[model samples]
Target chain A: MSQKSFVWFCLLPLAVVTTAFFLLPMARLVVAGAEGPHGLAGYLAILTEARYRATLINTVLLAAATTVVTLIVATIAGMFLQRHRFPGRAVLIAMLTFPLAFPGVVVGFMIILLAGRQGLIGDLSNRIFGEKFVFAYSIYGLFLGYLYFSIPRVILTIMAAVQKLDVGLEEAARSLGASPWAVQRDVVLPALAPAFVASGAIAFATAMGAFGTAFTLATNIDVLPMLIYTEFTLAANFATSAALSVGLGLITWLILALARSFSGSAVAAAG
Target chain B: MSTAGHGAAVRIEACGKTFADGTRALDPATLDIARGETLVLLGPSGCGKTTMLRIIAGLELPDVGGKVLFDGKDMTSVPIERRNVGMVFQSYALFPNMTVADNIAYGLKIRGVARGERAARVAELVALTNITGLENRRIDQLSGGQRQRVALARAVAIRPGILLLDEPLTALDAALRDRLRSELNRLLRALGITTIYVTHDQAEAMELGDRIVVMRKGAIAQIGTPREVYFAPKDRFVAEFIGAANIVEAPVENGVLILPGGRLPIECGATTANATVMIRPETIRVTEAGEGILSGIVDSVSFIGDRQRLVVSDASSKPLNVDAPNTIQARIGDRIGLSIAPDAVRLLPSEPRD
Candidate 1:
């Protein structure tokens, strides 16, 4: 065989696997989404139905909040961790990133151990205020769990970007009569913009589709993932569930694509 | 455009920088720079030249009891931002996010200058630095030389009292470095600002500095004009650092230095039985074999365009380097005589060899 034919033959396994496991399933899911009693309107029902619409809005808002909060917390912590050297710093970083090894279910369990009924916070509140305070089963608990896992991913990216920062830029800014805040605003943040866009997109996508944590928490949660889970298992509404699944994936993918395009244009204009 | 020279006389007293890890970057040294004078800290790498410049620029705080004064005002505790000093780094740290005009005008914007005034200042600096058409270009779009001009323009746009540059030309290629060195020298002279430049290149120190501070191993070895440092070096280190010098250690009897090749008269003050002396390569003239004050066989000859450098052995304990006129013809292993003026031989105090 010729060189190009040999290369194509080498890619035969990957092509077969992708078509069998990926394209076929995606095509089936799309067709199944339209095979229900509502037919083609099922996709529109995701936006027109009040219950589905509310759940979609809730998931988007949660993902956005997670991304914003993760970025802010990770940036500060990452800058400090990357810049300063002290005893136990390596250990601290190891502990912070230890969450990367955990699945979302484990993160949810840890949040429950901290804030669930009969958990640490509940026990302490019961002893101090004669009333138990618990929030582990609520959206607040899910938000906290998402933040727990999102922080490690975002912080690692931010720290890497921070390490590559040129100290001369900061010194130049200060020499140009910029205050500390102004230096960060003008130089450091702009330099780290690509990192933010990359890591924030990951954080947003992860929060948007995080199912294991919501599963281990409450079943009544109004997130799209939980909603789809209920519609698929409890209601056995395959068409609506598949449609909602497509909607969730498309929405998350659309937001990420938007972010990438915006950041891409920004980088081009910066140059 | 405003061209009112706002140079400030800077004085650093007893400034020493001992890093957190107990490494002494700079020894306690005191020096003063006159208004509108360009003082260069010249030394090898890790010789505390950059540390000294940082102390003066307020980027690094000196150890206790050290003070930096501007026009006799104590500025020891002042930070770099409040010190009103402009700094150009070796990396030419122009903000990559800002256009050239925006980078030049950033300082004015920080100072809350009016938009119209900031534009005028940016225009003046762009013209001054000869980067007028690059105003809208981002830093990454510019070449190394253009980035350097943008960095200088950004630093000077604020009308700072003192300019501190740290090896600004070391990042460029050789040809560009030489060209920019002369251009930068002219620019510094035109600005007439009290500037402190740091570089390991002796040629740069000679070309740009009015007074060069030769440093070594965290200490100031000598401080003088380029000519003074080159011709009348205070010690063997400065003599070897500023230019090529042949150090000959020999016994001095009466007024003549006893060498293996021949005895040469010394005009320097009374010397010990064993004396150390410095002879510049250019000072030793090549003549007929055995005709001048010293005679030896040529070991090697290198033709260096303007001058031919000859290494003559058997003339001293170590081989002597002689820079002869290019017109003079010499071959290896040929006997050659070298002429040296007594005044050109400088006696250096014997520093115990480590």
Candidate 2:
């Protein structure tokens, strides 16, 4: 075979896999989205319909909150873990990362065990306030479950980034009469911008599309994944579900791209 | 230049450092630095020079009961941010996230200086440090020398009371280090700030220090002017550390040192049978065989640019090093006479090595 044909032969398996698994399904999903009664406008139904629009907004807000909170908590924890050495430090780090091994359904169950009617928080609140406090079946439980899994993922990235940080930078700032808070604000956070964008994007995207946790939890929570599942399985509305899935994927991709570009500019300006 | 008078005298009284893991980094030491005087802490790695510098800078507090005073005011417990001291780390420690101008202006900004004044100060420092047009460039875009200049400018821009430099030029190449050494000397003289410099390089210590403190094993071995330390080191460690010295152990009889090569006259009142003496290489003059006070065979000759360094064996217990003029012609295995002046030989008390 010629050199070009030999190169094509080398790429044959990748080409076959891409067409068979990725391109074909994506094309079918798009076509199926447009085949509803409303035609291509069916894709617009995600935004125009009140119930679908509420779910979209709710999911976006939850994912955004999860990203912001995860970054804050992880940055603090990672900095402390990376900078100090105490007895049992290795064990503490291992425990913090244990959530990464668990599935989303398991994380949701853990949250229920903490805050459900028969759980620890309910038991404590009952003794203190003479009333049971339960939020396991609500959107709050989903938020907690998302936080449980997101912290582990973000904390590891932040710890690695913190390890790469030049300690002299902080010391130089301190020598220049900068308070501890000012040093973190001006020097450390800017240096960690790339890491924040990378890990935060993963967390935001994960929270947006996670279905297992919502399925195991109450079905009444207004998340985009739960709405799509009901439309597909309960109502047997194939076109609407396919359109919603495409919308969800597109929105997540667009937001992630926007975040990456923004962080790219920030990193360049920082340098 | 008006800020020169604002320099604060520093006193470190009974300062020592013991790490949490039980490593003694610095022994209890007392030192007084005059206002506007440059003091250099000279030692090898793990010798506690950096620990002493950190103690003065308030980055690391000394052991309990130790006190750091600025112009007689107690500053022992004060944090570094409130100490109003400037420091230049070995890595230069220029903030990579900020431009040169921003980095220089950051300290002033933190002090709540207005935008207009901050810019004026930045411009003045940029001009002083010869980094004018490069102010807008990011730190990573500059060369090593430029980064060093920026770090210096940033430290001095704040007009700190005391400037503490911890091996500031150690990260640069040799040629750049030499050039920057003189530049830094001139800058420190111009600023006239009470400065404490730390380095393991003896040449840097000799050139930049008003007084050099030679340290060993977390304790100060000797402290004196460069000439004093070089010619009159108190012990063998200081004698060998500051410069090359030929330490001779020989017997003293009738006010003369009896060596393997020949007898040399001495001035110190040493009636002991055996005594140790230090003689510098440059002080030994190479003369004709059997003519000078001592004679030996020239084992090796190295022709350096400015001088010829010769190792003459059978001179004493060990071979003696002699730095002769480059113009002198000498070959290996040639018998050479070495003459050292009476004042050039120093009697050192015998001390056990650690």
Candidate 3:
């Protein structure tokens, strides 16, 4: 056999395994949900019900907030690490990316230990303000938990982009009478726009689909994933749970599509 | 149009640059660039020419002791934004996010120029660079030559006091490089801007420089007009670098240098008993044995379009190259007489050969 054919033969099994384990299941779920009794109406329930609607809106809002906060923190950290050679820079970089390895539930538990009522920061705030301060189950608390995972992802993505950027552009801008801020705004930021959009999309998608952290911290909130879990376990309604799952999938697809459209243009502009 | 004669507008006094990692990229170097004149910094790779240009643009700071003066003002501490200088990079570095017009107007906008003024200036520069209809096109939409023109327009749009170009045409193809080199010279002359151009290409330096500064590893080798640097090189390195030269060892006796295979009369006042002889290929002429001072046999002959390159071997088998017009017919095995004009041969300082 030819070398090219031999290489294709070697890759065939892995491709089949991926298709069987991942793509087939996703296709089955999509097809089953579309052919269900209520058809597309079951997916529309997420947009029609006030509780589900608010939860969907809140999920999008929280994802956007997480993306924005993550982008700011990550961009600053990435630029600093790229341009400076401070002491312990490697240690700081490694520490920043450490959260990416931690499971979502572990991050949620750690946040609870630090910021929950009667926890470390909670006790300190209680002593300082003379009142019990609670953030463990709050929406803001969920945001903090989401950020623990999102920030590191954003940082790693942006750091790669920043490191690969040609520094001559900044020099050219500065020599053309651009201040440092103007250089960052007009040259650096525009060059980093693709990374910003890509990391923001990934962070938002991760936050939206987050299950373990949201379940551990904000159990009271009815995000689509949590509502589906509740429908299947608490209410023992398999069809409704499947329908809610379908709705969540559709929302994720729409979000991804929107992100793709926006980021594609941003990438084109940057290139 | 302003008719002021071109003269020195920027002076670099003992400028030096050492990076944080202790790499002395630029040693103490001083230069004066004339107003409305093009000064080309010619050097090999890592010769600190780009660093000097960067120092002039205020993109890099000179370490320890150095002063950059523009228009007789000590601008050592002035920020790049307030320095009012423009730069073109080797990679062009056009703003990919903006259209051609926006890239040209970026400096004007940063200086808070009015909308009407910025638009007018962008239009004027676009027209000047011959990219009039491409103002609304994005950077990626333009070809390589178009992008280079846009970069030039962007740098000159604000009428900066000093324009610095760092190997601007090095990224272009050969044919395009030649075209853009002449176009750039025309544009800079029309603008009458004080420009410092840096390139490692000797041909580019010779064609574009009003005065050329030849630099070697972190130091200035020689600074002079193109004719001075090329014809009268100060050292062996400068002589061999600017163009092809035949370097021969010779002994200076009775005002006539005795080469290994031939004797050439030279007039350089050399106190040393021995000196090196430098002769360009074009300076040597080939004729019959009785008509020329030295005789040799033609070892190789090759046609190079408009000229025929002849390599002649003397009694010692030392090969000397002579370039003649294409019409001169000399076969490889033919006997030839080579003679160099006494005035053409230069006696260089006897030093350890590089």
Candidate 4:
């Protein structure tokens, strides 16, 4: 075959898959909403209702909190893993990234086992407070579950970035009369900014779109993903559920775009 | 600035280091660098020259053998940051995240110099390195030569007691290397800073150093001025490493050394009956009369820039190199008489260590 035909042949399957899975569904969603009784009313419903508004707020807050917490814990852990030659460093890294391979539902279950009424920390809290502490039944529980998954993702990404950083920069800083802490603060931390931003954004997006963990840990907490599931299953509101999905996707896209822009500036400044 | 008559003297006595992988990186090295003198540690790779520099800079601690002294004060236990020694790395190691001004001001800032003082110091260093206009440029924007100069300026900005340079010119091209080498020597001399430069380039050592310490296998092979080390090498390795030499097997009898094709008289202060006679390539000349030690045929001739090199072969085809000025008209396959001055021929001891 000619080169043009061969190139077209190579892209045909990807085009067909993208159309069938992504483009067609998105087109149908847009058209279906337009065809609804109040045309565009369903999309407005997501922003108008107090419950939906609360869900959106909770989604954003939880994602932001998880991102911050994950970034702090993961960056510290990754730096420690990078700079120190401590025993069990390899094992620690493997264990930290092990959660990335786990299913979200499984991670939620593990969190429940550890922070539920009868679990290890749950038992200690119960004994201390003289009551069963239900960490699996609140917004706090969703955060715990999200953090369980987000921490590993952040750690792996930031660790790869840290490992790739030129070590001579730190040595130079130290030789230039910078103390160890100053070297880390002035040289190492600034160099890791882009990676930190990218990883934090990824963790935030993952936490926002997470459904299985939120569903498994939901009690009275109404996050966006759980609310959409409730709209689809109990309220029989597929149109509104699709609208919420679209909203979450757009929010995630906006955040990821902002992160990309920030990281691009960071890389340019570093270069 | 003090404009003191003497700089700080560094003394490293019997320092040794062994890595965790069982490789002895440095083994019981002892050196004393005089005030305001530039010392070049010359060696091939894995010779511990860089390691010694790192040890002096307090980046690496020697394994409990001796102490490092600066100006007669012991600083063996001091940390790198508190040691107040400047270092220029082979990679330049310019901070990519900072501008050139910020990089030069980094040490001053860490030392808690006030803002005005730090700025003044940075400005002074930029001017000293002739990069005053490039201060605001990021390190990535600067050329290799600019970056190296910035590194040198940054190193000297803190007014370090001693400066350590680890093959700083090896990364540059040949032309840049030569230019920077001369510039570096001039700067160091003008600053009058006690400096330790580590390099494998003998020409750089010869040109830039007040004293050259040739190292081999983590030990000092010889330490002397360039002229002392070059013309009066203490061992065969030093003689061969410093320049190209013609080493021939010779037996000493009655204070005369016998070669394969002829006999030559030499002195080595030893009574060994067997030795190797070493003569510099430029020392051997072609004479018109056959009154010299060896008569040979010119096997090959090649022209260097200002000189011509000829390889002379005897009956047994043992080759000896002869360097002559380009003014001489010599040809291949010409029968020639090779003359060696008695003072130019030195006897290498027979029982030489590898």
Best by TM-score, which number? 1
lDDT accuracy of residue A196 in candidate 1? 91
Task: Looking at model 2 chain B, report the run of 10 residues with the lowest lDDT sum.
Answer: B267-276
* Tens-digit lDDT string for candidate 2 (B1-354): 666756899999999999998999999999999999999999989999999999998889999989999999999999999999989988988887788999999999999999999999999889888889998898879999999899999998899999999999998999999999999998999899999999999999999999999999999999999999998999999999988999988889877999999989988846777788899999999999889999899999999899989999998889999999999889999998989899899999887756
Docking class of 3: medium
- What lDDT would candidate 3 get against the real structure? 0.83
| DockQ winner between candidates 1 and 3 | 3
lDDT of 2 by residue, A1-271 (tens): 9999999999999999999999999999999999999999999999999999999999999999999999999999999999999999999999999999999889888888999879899999999999999998888899989998899999999999999988888989999999999999999999999889999999999999998888788888999999999999999999999999999999999999999897886677554
In order, the Cα lDDT scores of the candidates are: 0.93, 0.92, 0.83, 0.84
Candidates, ranked, TM-score: 1, 2, 4, 3
In the predicted model 1, the residue pairs found to clash are: none
TM-score of chain B of each: 0.97, 0.98, 0.94, 0.94
Proportion of native contacts found in each model? 0.79, 0.81, 0.76, 0.66
Model 3 lDDT per residue over B32-114, tens place? 87678889999999999999988888878888689999978998888777887888888899888888899999888988899
Model 1 Cα lDDT, one tens digit per residue, B1-354:
344466799999999999999999999999999998999999999999999999999989999989999999999999999998999999998888888999999889999999999998888889888898999987788999999999998888888999999999999999999999999999998998989999999999999999999999999999999999998999988988888999999999778999999989989656567899999999998889869989999999999999989999999999999999999889899998988999999999899886
- What is model 4's DockQ versus the real complex? 0.71
Candidate 4 chain A has its poorest 10 consecutive residues by lDDT at A30-39
Model 2 scores a C-alpha lDDT of: 0.92
Here, model 4's chain A TM-score works out at: 0.92
In candidate 1, stretches whose alpha carbon ends up further than 4 angstroms from where it belongs are A1-13, A127-130, A268-271, B1-4, B269-271
Sorted by DockQ (best first), the order is 3, 4, 1, 2
By the DockQ metric, which is better: model 1 or model 4? 4
TM-score of chain A of 3: 0.91
